[model samples]
Target: MDGGNNGGRINVAIDGPAGAGKSTVARRVAEQLGYIYIDTGAMYRAVALAANRAGVLPSDADRLAELVKTVDITLEPGADGQIVRLGGENITTDIRSREVTLKVSEIASHEAVRLRLVEMQRKLAEAKGVVMDGRDIGTHVLPGAEVKVFLVASVQVRALRRYQELSEGELVPLEQLEQEIADRDRSDESREFSPLVRAKDAEVLDSTELTIDQVVAHILDLCRTKTAEAK
Candidate 1:
């Protein structure tokens, strides 16, 4: 078993590939623990959104860094959940648009962008009581976190789930969603700095056949156990 029982407050780091229910599980775990849930992925998505607005191509590293510096990124919670504000303007809905998704992987693959965002993520997690979720949280963002959970699921399952969500509003076919999921995994895994990988000490949880509540409960149990030990 993972050792080190102390009174230090716990920080949960959840990492995984695309469509792996990382966001949902992390949010619930944070809510149950009364901790702030910071979505590091949203920061990259915001950068992508800003790049699109500035007309900076993905390869334009200098322009991308400049654009990131000019923006003030903040996380605010609402009744629904967290909202991402860039430059004091809430672009929460715009950041999750299809266009942002298309460009996010490219921007995220940039070393400059990831480094800048990683610093921000670290600052946000400086306080112990936080549950941060992202592709690299377990490995790079919060290596010293008390509990590191790497959530994974089969590509087919993830693709189908994403397709179902998209289909609720738009008419996206299964094949298209599968292709997008595959492409995103490729980008996330192949990125140079802090590519997605489970930390050696991370607890691997495969959600391939589990319901959302089941996964949330699984993570919550771990969180509670860790918190009890740390007390």
Candidate 2:
């Protein structure tokens, strides 16, 4: 992360588990604050997708690390949402597919891959005014962010929210999805390379019974307070 604050811009880091509405909330919060929204999870998914296509297995850490460097993944603002491009090819939707989802955690576990992506992430936040959301945003990516939040929800709530986001045909059984999310939580927390963790200074917000707008509003109020304090 940038070591110096340039001005009034606030770097908001939202970290949490999968299916906890981090991306949606982060985007809304950033839009409301007029800050740049970076979904680092999508960046990992992009690497996963590229590796899957190149006949590379997730265990091939060295190769996967090299592949991601050449892929040149980039995130661009889009009318519908954030557009993720790989090697300059628009693959926003592709990266979100189930295949990539299964590979992302494993791919992200590699130290080299994480280091390379972290460099890119830091560069994006150099000018501040950024709201970056992902598993380790607060703990690892931007530890010094002005505002840090670890958003979470109950397993059932998370599964249902994720279920609602998927199309009818692509939907997985709720029970199975919940189990998978639980398993993912385990993997994320157990991983050796900057495992998913909440920063000591980060405030936790449980969204098990909260609405998206409510979550965004809560974060916004926190951001405004932090911004004022910094000023």
Candidate 3:
């Protein structure tokens, strides 16, 4: 929502549905380009996880905002990967848990929650040179981002990927994974606040057949070209 100007540093926005490889590809592309990788999804997940810990329901917007102001959401990189901390506690693993995944859509639909987090997201990119990935980054979060990419893949592929990830840790039937993906997609696209959407000018990348390295390479080329033209 912040329409500020960037004096330097190329901004890249990667918007995609769940299981489309946006996080992994964005991180790789950012790393290759020496840009900061901002995982906007993790930001929301952090908030939802925090709310759950504090016994605040998804609809409790008033307490959520209060908690937001008091909570410290910092992005730190380590040997494992980017660590998202809330109130100085490392909840990186907690954010990606099943509970947060089930409730995040409801929390994300709250306008106040979105506004507060959008402000934080804006601050992260205010320095300009960053690659951010999320559902709405290219549309509502960072409309003026220099490079906007909307990645997509078939629903079957997405479901399979999610199943694979969940199956690694625990038992998740394919049918359950498929239903979960459909449910999340519907919620994300139908949310009232900043619903998942592709920006008008965003270039769409269908990764149904493309490998992770291929996707990263393609995005890197587009980012480099766009950054050069902006200068």
Candidate 4:
């Protein structure tokens, strides 16, 4: 694993829009590389969860800022994937709920949340053996990362993937899910701070027709190439 990477390892940054399978792909890639997986979106989702439970509106920046400071959000590896903890509670499943998903963008749009979480994310990547996935990671969080992959898929494709992940009781119409994902894409891209633009040097991967294993394999190949170049 230490083959040609600088300082014995490399940082892999993955950025993408909603429901693009970024979290799954990044987690798998991190597992294969023996790297820590940092789900930056989950951090925001944790904030959204905290906000939701606290009755704090996303528009209330000062309140949100105070709320973030008082909460503790952490990501740790689990048997299945990354586990998220908020205030010492296992919120891995909670953060992925549709409510948190819908509010995450709004919470993340606040400069207070982004500034604080981005600092934490940057600190996590400083160790060099981390795979981070989020909208602004490659563009802002880790611009000099050794490897950057921007994953993308059609909105319908992404929405279907998300739909399959949700349990039956939480099901929404596929058409509605598609529209939600599309709206999120526009919101993410048009956000004033750290919008979801692919980094200039990042490799763009369209995984609309690719399996999870196929996408992981392709990213591993890129990791090898970048690590070799780092030598």
Query: Once superposed on the true structure, which residue ranges of model 3 sit more than 4 Å away at CA?
Result: 1-8, 167-169
What is the Cα-based lDDT of residue 202 in candidate 2? 98
Q: Which rank order by lDDT, best down to worst? A: 2, 4, 3, 1
lDDT tens digits, residue span 6-101, model 4 = 366899999999988898999999999999999898899999999999999988999999988778988888898888998889998888888888
Per-residue lDDT tens digits of candidate 3, residues 104-215? 8888888888888889899888778789999999999899898999999988899898877773666778888778888889999999889999999999999999999999
Q: Per TM-score, what order, best first?
A: 2, 4, 1, 3
Backbone clash count, each prediction separately: 0, 0, 0, 0
Question: TM-score of the candidate numbered 3?
Answer: 0.93
Q: Candidate 2: which stretches are off by over 4 Å?
A: 1-5
**RMSD to the native, candidate 1?**
2.7
Model 3 residue 204 CA deviation in Å: 0.6
Instruction: Compute each candidate's TM-score over C-alphas.
Output: 0.93, 0.96, 0.93, 0.96
After superposition, candidate 1 runs with Cα above 4 Å error: 1-8, 167-169
Model 2: lowest-lDDT 10 consecutive positions: 1-10
Model 3, position 48, has a per-residue lDDT of 91
The lDDT of each candidate is 0.86, 0.91, 0.87, 0.90
Full-model lDDT, candidate 1: 0.86
